[model samples]
Target chain A: MFELLGIPPQALFGQVLLGLINGSFYAVLSLGLAVIFGLLNIINFAHGALYMMGAFVSWMLLTYLGIPFWFALVISPLVVGALGMVIERTMLRPLHELDHLYSLLLTFGLTLVITGVFQNFYGVSGKPYPIPAALTGVMNLGFMFLPIYRGFIIVMAVIVCFATWFLIEKTRLGSYLRAATENPEMVSAFGINVPLLVTLTYGFGVALSAFAGVLAAPVYSVNPVMGNDLIIVVFAVIVIGGMGSIMGAIIGGFSLGLVEGLTKVFYPEASTTIIFIIMALVLLFKPSGIFGREV
Target chain B: MTHTIEKSQADTPGPETQAMLEVQGLNGWYGESHVLHDVNLTVNKGEVVTLLGRNGAGKTTTLKAIMGLLKSRSGSIRFNGTELIDLPARDIARLGIGYVPDDRGIFGSLSVLENLLLPPKVADGGFDLPAIYELFPNLEERLDSYGNKLSGGEQQMLSIARILRTGALFVLMDEPTEGLAPVIIHQIGHTVRRLKKAGFTILLVEQNFHFARELADRHYIVQEGKVVDQFRNDEIADNLEKIQGYLGI
Candidate 1:
């Protein structure tokens, strides 16, 4: 048993592992926010609520419908993404020409509605989602002990983040999405159905959030208000990373998570406030964000 | 100044050649600002026309209105005998009409090759990569450069080249030579002549009198959002002073 700075190695490793887990969530969630903001220019306030829906939907599938976790993983995101598309076409489409505030307000109201419905049915108490049988063990790596489920989460988050980056930076569809984000009229002039593109982008953006939610289901409590709290942290990560930068979102998430984890080790009281403090300092110096190009 | 435009009467379509594009009583606005008013014009098949005007004379607005880019536009815009007044910009583009704006809307973040390949092929005759490269060798040289990184002339060329790849029968080019060195301007003029020879109908908007005179078969003098005057290529020689006077150049 090794000790560094008066903290035992196991305790330090435990906190670091927890930080990685939280970082994974931030990376995936912030990636969604970035994608949505890039294309729609709307800060999706309902993202947290939608993420909660993903977890709850997966929970319900297993509890009432006898659906396994594997099947629920695929089913939950699809359901949430379909709902996201409906939201875009019906609520967000008409607000496109107006100020961005309207969309934000609308999504905020939607967040309340969705969270309220879930709370009404399920209440506030967190429900446990049993970890799958295959990932129900711990790995001891000399200096640290890692839960297989947490390692799975970290790996999944990294894969999802990189896959999203590759999709946007290396593909033709991504080129159109990026081009449309810059100038929708010009992209439309190129004969692309930009309205349809916008609709799909919104759906895809929220789908990423939902996918993150599915991933979080096993780790965090499947509670209605779970996303409401996590989303704020993700927003901080976005501000620090730069809005709409794929690479920035991914890196910002993990780095902030680790910083928070390290803070927990040094001063337990400041663990939560450190992200906001860093966000403020980053805003003061690099307002465009770490990866953001000039707006 | 160096040459009077070769009047390509042989290339100009006859009066019986049905109009390729016709705009009747077209009106457009930017919010409350009325930009184009009662603009009526026609582009006959295989003819290169110019919309000659000073800045903010509604030349660009007319082109935008025809392309359905302006949301508050009304009246008639008929392309290839099909009514196009209410079509979305995307639908209008899909109908085989291409636009090259004065600002040259190249995606700054995208590479030159991406910008060139961005526009989808609209018809069978659209320029392929080899043809586009052959037409503008400069584009081939800067294939990997970002759109914003290109020189002004290169951006303009890329802008024009992008539309040419769309196989659009009618191209509405707005001030293609707004700011360019003489050599690049000369090259654009040469390209315009070659396109006209290749049977592409063009409705060009230009503030440059010398450049427009060299490429346009007919000229429409726009004054404050209205079509104030029109003259044939032969009439251009006699009306050079009038054209200059109208443009206030």
Candidate 2:
């Protein structure tokens, strides 16, 4: 029953836990955006749509095939990733020689088409995805009650983010990716199939987003527009973290989520606008972003 | 010199002599601008061939076209008897033709080791790490440094070392001595000669005629993207005045 800042400890801790959960999603989503932008040099406007597809795919698997949540988690990303690869090879590849604006417009249109298809079938209402029985309980952590599923999500997101970072920074394949990101022409001249690399990178990035969606289905309602609106916030996170920066996106996502959570407790009215405000301030002062190199 | 030329001419396993690379009628364009016009050249096995020209003479463009880096190119670029004109840049590289671009093309995000390891070995005879270290000792010292962090000389060395590690039988070096100190240029000259002596064919692009004169077995004087003249290194000594006139410097 103890109180801190004139608020109950339970309420405060609950908000903080919620913040951490949101932070995990932000980190994973923004990481996907950063990875895609790093090599492809295109802001995938369809990222949200892909994320939504992940959740829908999971739901569809569960309903149509009686597949469980755990299996859906494993399979949905691969399905979505393959779809992303197709989009890159068929749609985004031709736009590489053109202006960047065209790709952005194309992906934006793709987002609409995908959302429209889902809405036509499922409508705008949210569908519930029941949590697996193994994760359907809460753990008492002395200070606060933690949902086992939430804790699992936090751990999984952290692991995925760290793994991606390690893959890019430490490994030989990662070195090729980073090098290709800087100069694909040079990388190709070095005998790397850069087009194949591009396709796989875009696919990997989309898979990451879809993985986050799979994780999110149990927490948020599975809706047609779930990813559509969340993507705008993630874009703000990318801008704040510094576009195309891997570590920056991870840090920016978690920190912004915490800030948003704190705002909800202190000033509920400004919770939605806090991230945008910080983005504007960052743009004004450091347009390259917190982790972005000066062009 | 005649012994090496004749040795290359003989196919008795001395060193696989014969023209290793023959580029004929290479014309390149950048969008609508024609950069290379009817460029023709050849490089015998184990020979160092230098393409000497002033700036904007399409020396680099010639290399680009030959390497298949320029897509809007039409020419016969045959390396190791493989037709390279229709292949992609990567395929050309896979054919044991390594390219060290003019800008050095070092990725700033990669470490010295990563840059060296980026190129896949195209053949069995590529230089290993210890061999590369012995050639460019400075690169070994700065293996952990990022590619862009190295000095101009070290970067150039890394670029050359990178291609050499790919086991490329033939290398297209674009201005290996560009933007370096005189001392470093001397070191590069030494390295180029060392590579040649190791049985690698080199097609060098150089504005430094004096440097080229010392290292190359044959010289191709490129002017306005065309091979204006071809002569032996000994002939360069006799035709120095005329060569300088053609080079305009």
Candidate 3:
């Protein structure tokens, strides 16, 4: 009954809702990257693989133990986050004194090993994780039929991002983290246990990615390489947002997803390349990013 | 060479004369370049001891070694009879040692209040907020401002004010009076005197002989990464020329 700009409202609104869903994942994942990079000073290249593991952990929990989506949701992140702490302590601790590149390569190598192991076990084909019973139906929002589970993803992502921002910005522990981010030696010299704070920060950051993984499992397929492709886009989202800025990551992620979605509606051929184009433009003009300050 | 290994007979702490810190044969290196060869010194309880030397003569390095900040160092740093060489900087701090670095490490992103509250409490009996405010009224006035935005004297006061709240009995001050206006230097000297009266052991590193001579009870002349000589405050009048010769002032 209604058409705007030669495009039907259903198609436009449909893609916009889909864009919001993808935006939720991007916001959560990029937020994790920013937090980790800020405190640990290392690019977590294994993040995508960890996201995949979160999905796998949930899948395994449901398939083998007859656990449901709700329980798997809570368990998967905890399990993955515990593993993250182990990675930080055993693998990354020794390289603390080395250059940032070493940790990046190490995490990248971890990505390969994790991907290889998952591929060996699960094969390239993806598995389908069913939507929970309560969220199976779609809500008719006059403009579009919105999937309830998709809306839940968006709401949950906002809650998580807000909580993380509050923790880093408003609390005393957050003040310690910010100070440590600036100069860890002085923080530790002040008698705060900086290494312990580091491990906990890394664990929490990884858990954010794992949370996104579980959220993506129901919408996307539970595949070993599921996060592999999405993570590249998330990195571009971070670059456009600014490398270590929390607000930048959240705003950059959601807006870019919308841009990508609208591009699909207006020009289908350029949807995938639009984010990279913006990234290149941002790097050329403001290398520190929109929210990042001068070094 | 003549000092004890953290427990020299000359520095033996007793009830009447308590030795707070004893650093013996402290050798430090920045990667391959050795900065400190043999640094032997002692600071008794409530005594303000100054490590007087020219720039780069290992005075700062000695303080850093004592604080366990250096990457590589070999020495005995004892605080209250505890061997501190093997401990981490945080642990050393927990042992009641407060550090006010030469550059005055103040976090730019944090507010002045946050910087003052940055250090966790290491012991009991430290200056409370009201007391710190009384000492440095400028900090209380600039509580809402960002740390790096403060003036140099304010930054120095913030730097020292931070650890004073931690209840640390011993303070390692590296050039607190350096690069300050004359009025600020005089203010710092006044603060140091008050702190001494209140019974805080101080290990000061200074190129300013006049500042050292006024505040310190004893002075150790450090040259070429070693402690060349030491004397009491009364001995300063007898060895003023010798002290000026060593400091090259």
Candidate 4:
């Protein structure tokens, strides 16, 4: 109904909501990347593939097995995480003592294999997952109309982000994660099984990506190459935020998403490139990242 | 699991009857280089023994080998009747060994309380928080502080305190007083004496003979990668010149 600087309130609100939605994906995906990088120092190039797997797995469950979105949400991640754990133990764990480049290559190859298989079976055209029956309507909040599912996404991202904070900062298991990340040998000497922790941490990190993937399934087209494009943006978020702190990743993701959204409103052509430009600026000035001091 | 460690302890001899630790013909390598050649030594229950050596003389490596910290190590490291050479550092720790390293490997990210809580309880009879704080009052005062925030002396104390909480009767300390004020060294010495009185076996590596002289019942002098000589605390009085001349200090 109102206009500011010749931009209608509807356009601004609509894009702002879109920005928040994209930010939620960034937050969830980058949280997993930051955690994996912090402890394992592995780049996990297959992160995007795993995310695609999460969405596709959920899609498979809904289509083939007649499972609902809620059940698929929990089941998809567990199945994907279990697969991730096996990959860690069999493939990544042996290369733990080697250089980071080895794991990077290993994961990159893994990404290609996953992408190729999915593309072979499904092709490039995408499948659209239907929004659940309960979350189909929109709520009119005076000047702005909010889609309930979209609002649900924003709330879910906030919840997931804060839950990670609790898991990493507050609990005793978190203490071990923090300690082991610093000097795993010392922690091992202190009588803790660090190898097992690494395996679990890898599984958990990928599980977050899968969870984000399931959240994304209903929003985005469930295609093989869907994660291929989004992962680059998610990684940019991690680079800008610095895989150092959980909160840093969350804020970085949300803020960058909003920036991209705003760019879409002001200049449609620059929306995609804006995040990369900021990422370059961040890397040039603060190479350690905004949350650089922490691990 | 804790069961692996507990089961080994149960098979050992009763307390005070035999040697708490018996390391024989131990050898260790760091990558391509051999560091420890023949580090044979023993520490009976409740006894205090010191590994005396100059820098780079393999004293620290001996301790590392015993604890299974080295990836390539050989020969026997028996702790309370369990052959420990095959076990990993963590398993050896679970078999009732506490290690305080030279660098005081404190996790900077964790708070003081978390550092203390990091090591799982290995056995019964470990000092409770009140008892540990009584021994090192500074730790209690700085419980909320980060591990990296502590002073050199406090970090050293924290390192020692955390291990003591593990109820590990066989204690291995590598230069606990390496860089500390005189007062702090005296306090550590007093703690060692008290630990001996409480029936904990100590295998300490020291270049500070004065500190070693006061606390050790026996001293094993390391040269290069072998135990070249040994002296009982009583017998060291007569061999002071030879010991000092050998030490070159």
Counted clashes in each candidate structure: 0, 2, 0, 0
Order by DockQ, highest first: 2, 4, 1, 3
Candidate 1 chain B least-lDDT 10 residues: B1-10
DockQ in order: 0.71, 0.80, 0.65, 0.76
CA lDDT, every model vs. true structure: 0.89, 0.89, 0.89, 0.90
Candidate 4 lDDT over B4-120, as tens digits, reads: 222333434433467889989898999999988878888887688999989899998898888888889999988879999999999999988999999999999899999999899
The top-ranked prediction according to TM-score is: 2
Q: With candidate 2 superimposed using the best TM-score fit, by how many Å does residue A139's alpha carbon deviate from the native?
A: 0.5
Per-residue lDDT over B1-249 for candidate 3, one digit per residue giving the tens place of the 0 to 100 score: 221112222432332387889889889999999889978998998789999989888898898899889869887888989999899999999999999999898998899999998899999778888888888988999999998799999999999999988989789999998899999999999988877766678999999899988998899999989999998988999998998899897
Clashes of 3: 0
Candidate 2, residue B65: how far the Cα is off, in Å: 0.5
Interface RMSD of every candidate?
0.6, 0.6, 0.6, 0.6
Q: Which pairs clash (backbone N, Cα, C closer than 3 Å) in model 3? A: none
**Model 4 whole-model lDDT (C-alpha atoms):** 0.90
Return the TM-score for each candidate structure.
0.96, 0.96, 0.95, 0.96
Candidate 2 per-residue lDDT, tens place, A1-295, comes to 7886788888888888888888898999999999999999999999999999999999999989999999999899999999999999999999999998999999999999999999999999999999899998999999999999999998998999999999999998899899999998888887889999999999999999999999999889999999977899999999999999999899998899889888888888999999999999999999999999999
Q: Give the lDDT of residue B206 in candidate 3.
A: 95
Winner by DockQ between candidate 3 and candidate 2: 2
